[model samples]
Target: MTKIPAISLRRLSKSFGDLDVLGVMDLDVGRGEFVSILGPSGCGKSTLLSILSGIEEATTGEITIHGAPLNQSGQPFAWMPQNDALLPWRTVVDNVGLGYQVAGRLSKRAARDQARLLLPAFGLEEFSRALPYQLSGGMRQRVALARTIAQGRDMLLLDEPFGALDAITRTELQLWLEQIWGVDRPTVILITHDVREAVLLSDRIYVFSDRPAQIVAEFEVPLDRPRTIEMLAGAQATQLELDLLRALHVGSGDTP
Candidate 1:
């Protein structure tokens, strides 16, 4: 028998009054799969993430995870938005443990303890007591990631988690994220504008058209993981990147 998808969106659409953002979208993210939704900025990509996370409701259609209605179920999905959104006054450990405290119903100390165990993996062990302002942008993102994982969620919804970092830092975090996901594959739906980032991290990629957005094409990343930036320089990965780029361009009515 076929395994149920980790996430399923059917004929989903969203609008703000007269302005439609997503128009009749459908998507499936399989169990333990890493999928990326790549599109140009302001194409309702982040809006889609918000809708799936229940931060925003779809105007029409349904969202399900594991065959259960997403909003109706006590869905255990973690959402990490573009900004790290860390509390400035909180120490790293406290910030990283916040989600665990709320979702896992652990005491503050217990939450900190649990989060501490994950700090080293996310490269924040040394800064556990440091404030968010004391850390770099990338470090803050790591803490946010650790916090998301602390919730013990099986699905991760990342909205350009590394989008604001410097190029080198973003690349490093992408590799780190892959290593974590490789070991314990949680279903991931990453929204990103970077084609190369999508190619490097995703098992499959869905390219979306401009506003009133919908998927225009999908590509399977042919490279095997433990994928590396070096692998992205190879012919197959390059071609995939070019193909995605061309698809985005064409979807936006630009000549490739």
Candidate 2:
């Protein structure tokens, strides 16, 4: 028998009054798979994430998780948005544990203890007591990710988690993220506009068209896991990057 998909979307669409944000779309993300949705900026990519996270209701569609209908009664995913969104007043450990506390799943003390254990893995052990204001942008994102991981959700919804950082920092975090994802293998759905980033991190990529988005093309990355920066420079990776770029250009109605 075939294993059920981690996530399945059929005829998914979203609209706001007179504005349509997403057209009918279908997608499937396999268990423990890293899938990226690549498209131009302002192409309703984030809207899709919002719908999946239950922050926004879909205009029409069906969404299933593990072959069952999506139920929003409890948190189904660990969502990390574009900005780190760390609370400035909270220390790193407390920030990481906030979700558990808010959900009443753990006492504050227990939550912090759990978050402390995860800190070393993210290279954030030394900064456990530091406030968000004291951390660098990259460090803040790490804390944000640690917080996401602390939730222990099977699916991770990342809405351009590294989009705000500098190029160097972003690349560093991508490699770090790949290593972390390798160890735990949580199913990931990443929304991004960067072609090279998509090719480097995704097991498969779905390219979307401009506003009122629809998937225009899909590519399977076939590269080995624990992906490194060096691999991105290899001929196969380079070709995949070129192909994704071409698709993005065509999807957005621009010449490549």
TM-scores for all predictions: 0.97, 0.97
Please give me the total number of clashing residue pairs in predicted model 1: 0
lDDT of 1 by residue, 68-156 (tens): 99867785589998888898888999998998898889999999989889898888878999999899988989999998888899999
Models, CA RMSD each? 1.1, 1.3
TM match of model 2 to true structure: 0.97
Candidate 2 C-alpha lDDT tens digits along 1-256: 3888889999999999999999999999999999999999999999988988889999998999888888743667888888888999999999999866765389999999888888999999999999999999999999999888887788899999899899999999999999999998999999999888898899999999998999999999979987989998899999999888888889999775
Q: What's model 2's overall lDDT?
A: 0.91
Number of clashing residue pairs in every model? 0, 0
lDDT, candidates in the order shown: 0.91, 0.91
- Over the full model, what C-alpha lDDT does candidate 1 score relative to the true structure? 0.91
